[model samples]
Target: MSKRLRSILTPIIAVLLGIIVGTIIMLVSGYNPVDAYTALWNGAFGDVYYTGEVIRQVTPYILAGLAVAFAFRVGLFNIGVEGQFIVGWLAAVWVGVAFDLPKVIHLPLAIIAAMVAGGLWAFIPGLLKARFRVHEVIVTIMMNYTALHTVNYIIRTKLNQGSAKTGMIHESASLRSPWLQELTTHSTMHWGIMIAIACCFIMWFLLEKTTRGFELRAVGFNQDAAHYAGMSVNKNIILSMVISGAFAGIAGAMEGLGTFGYMAVQGGFTGVGFNGIAVALLGGNTALGVFFSALLFGSLKIGALSMPLEAGVPKELVDIIIALIVFFVASSYIIRVVLDRFSKKGVK
Candidate 1:
């Protein structure tokens, strides 16, 4: 099988296997798999409201997935996306609440603040990795804790008067659209989806049609070779993390300005950044692939809520299915070997 065929088939087969395993688990747990799946389907796309919610969920997933995939392309493991996302959300909310400018200026300024915060948050680990050969994964993981506590402290001491969250952002700084809400029957959808889609195209163009992208890819493929070719490996590494963090920042902006319109103190990780790793993996780490994979993940997340409400199935079952899918995708070498054997036999 060709590489392209293998790439396409692997995720499809993984998804099928996940569904099969989920069915068996549901049966063992005394639930009707058919009813459960039907409910899941309905919750995702049965009405305009649900569809809009799915799209809204997908918007952040797409940006977060791109963040991870971009780092992967540069051979960097950016475990700090969660931290970056939180800081970005906080920064955007700060700007949104503090400014009283016109809609165009306020909105763009808030969004830029988000991107800058996220980028700067990631830059610390990137700088360490590039300048001191520090392990980025460890640093980023630690940074996640720092970001969590720091944001909580800021919220308690600075932003919130008595509540656990800052005030709602100004209307001019918000991403919500009244027309879009009416069109989607009041789903929490926003213009962030358009930004996500535009980022997808930008990612594709940058990675596939630019000299800088070639350098980044080259550095990722072989640092020694890239150095020999006069490419600045350190620069690319820093640039990659910065760009990846920017994507993740926009994801946070979607949650802050578009979905929630406020920044809240969190007791734990939001899981969106972590889920982006699975999205990137399932997408084969490509821009277009990330877009579609995010949709699938988003659908599962939104639909999971209906499983229990409609079919008496546990919502956690959906988590199991998602875990299985990721497992199968990660273990795709086994599938590839099996396909190769079949191809060899057919050739004979």
Candidate 2:
């Protein structure tokens, strides 16, 4: 099989296997898989409100997926997306609450602040990796804790005067749309989805059509060869991380401005950043793939909520299903071997 064909078939096969395994698990657990899956489908698409909600959830996932995928393109594992996301969220909300400008100015300003904050947060690990040969994984993992506590401190001591949440952002800065709400029976859908889709295009173009993108890919394929080709390995490394962080920051903005319109003292991590790793892996680290995988994730998440009410199946089953999907994707080598055997038999 061609590389492109293999890449396409791998995820499709993984998804099918995941569903099949989920069905077996449900059957063993004395549950009807058919009813459970039907309920899942309905919950994600039965009503206009549910459909709107899926889109809302998907908006951030796309950006977060892009963040992780972008780093992967340059051979970086940005485990700090969570830290960058949190800081970006905090900065966006800070700008939203602090400003009193027109929508044209205020909204863009808040979003830009989020990007800058996220980029800066990722910059530390990137710089360390480039300059001192530190492992980015370790630094970014440590930074996640640092961002969580520091944001909590800032929220309690500075932003809200001991409250767990910050004040609501001004109307001008909000991503909420009255028209969309009306259309979706008052779901929380907003303009953030548009931004998310635009970023998808931007990522595609940058990675596939730009000189910098070529250099980044070269560095990722083999850093030694990239260096011999006279590319600035260190510069590309830093730039890739910063851009990845910027995308993650936008994911946070989708929550702060579009979903909640404020920042809060997070009891723990949101899990979105960590999920991005799975998303990037499932999507084969491509922009188009990320978009589709994110939609699947959004559907599974929104649909799982209905499993309990409709079919008496636990929502946690969906988590297992997602995990299985990731496992299968990670084990693509085994699947490829199977495919090869089948292909040879067919030819014979």
Candidate 3:
């Protein structure tokens, strides 16, 4: 199969196998598997409102998925995407509420602040890895906690504009579109989705069309080899982290500006950042793949909440199904075994 064909088929097959396994689990648990899936489908795409909600959920995933996928291409395991995302949100919102400007300028400026914050958040760990030869995984993982506490401190302080959250962003700076709001009284879905789609194309262009991307990929496959081949291994690694963090920053901007319109004290780590890991994997760490996978996940999430009302199942059941799918995808040995057995039967 062509690489593109395989890239599309692999995830589809994995999802089917995951569904089969989930069915078995549900049957064992005394639930009707067919009913469960039916509920999921009806809940997610049953109506226009539900469908819009799915779009809302997927918007952030696109950016977060790109964040992880970009880092993966550079051979860096970034475990602090959650941290970078939060810092981005905090920074963007700070800019959004702290100043007043023209519509075109204010919104874009806030978004830029978010990107800068996210890049700086990731830079510290990148520096630690490059300068001290520290393991990037360990360094990035620790940085997640640092981001969590640092943001929490800022939120509790007056930095949040004398409230749990800053005042509502200026109407001029808002990304709210009247067209989408007509469906749901209010939803977070906004122009961020357009930006995310554009970014996906940008990522594809960078990876396929740019020399810097080639150097980054070279470093990822083999740093020592890349070093010998005239590539600056350290610089590439640092650049990779910068790009990765900037993607996460855009994710923060989507949530704070598009959805919330203000900075609020984050009660906890939003799972979206961690969820980026799975999206990256399922998408094959590619730009186009991440876009579709993000939509899939967004649908699954929107459906998860509706399943309870439609099927009398807990929302967590959907999480369990997703977890199983991710687990099976990670352990391809199972799929290999299944495919091997089917081949043997054909030979017989």
Q: Quick one: best lDDT, which candidate?
A: 2
Per model, state how many residue pairs clash. Answer: 0, 0, 0
Tell me the TM-score of each prediction against the true structure. 0.98, 0.98, 0.93
lDDT tens digits, residues 253-329, model 1?
A: 99999999998899999998999999999999999999999999999999999999999998999999999999999
Off by over 4 Å in 2: none
Which runs in model 3 stand beyond 4 Å of their true positions?
1-5, 161-163, 183-185, 333-348
The residue-by-residue lDDT of candidate 3 on 1-348, one tens digit each, is 244555566677787777788788888877777777788888788877777677778888999999999999989999889999999988888887878899899999988998999998888878887778888889878888888888888878767667776778776667779887777545556778888898899889998799998998998899999999999888888888989999999899888888888777777789889999989888989999899889888888888786677776677877887887788678755666666676578789
Any idea what lDDT model 2 has?
A: 0.94
Candidate 1's TM-score: 0.98
Tell me the lDDT of model 1 at 316: 94
Q: Per-prediction RMSD in angstroms?
A: 0.9, 0.9, 2.2
What lDDT tens digits, residue by residue, belong to model 2 across residues 15-116? Answer: 999999999999999999999999999999999999999999998889999999999989999999898999999999999999999999999999999999
Q: What overall lDDT goes with each candidate model? A: 0.94, 0.94, 0.84
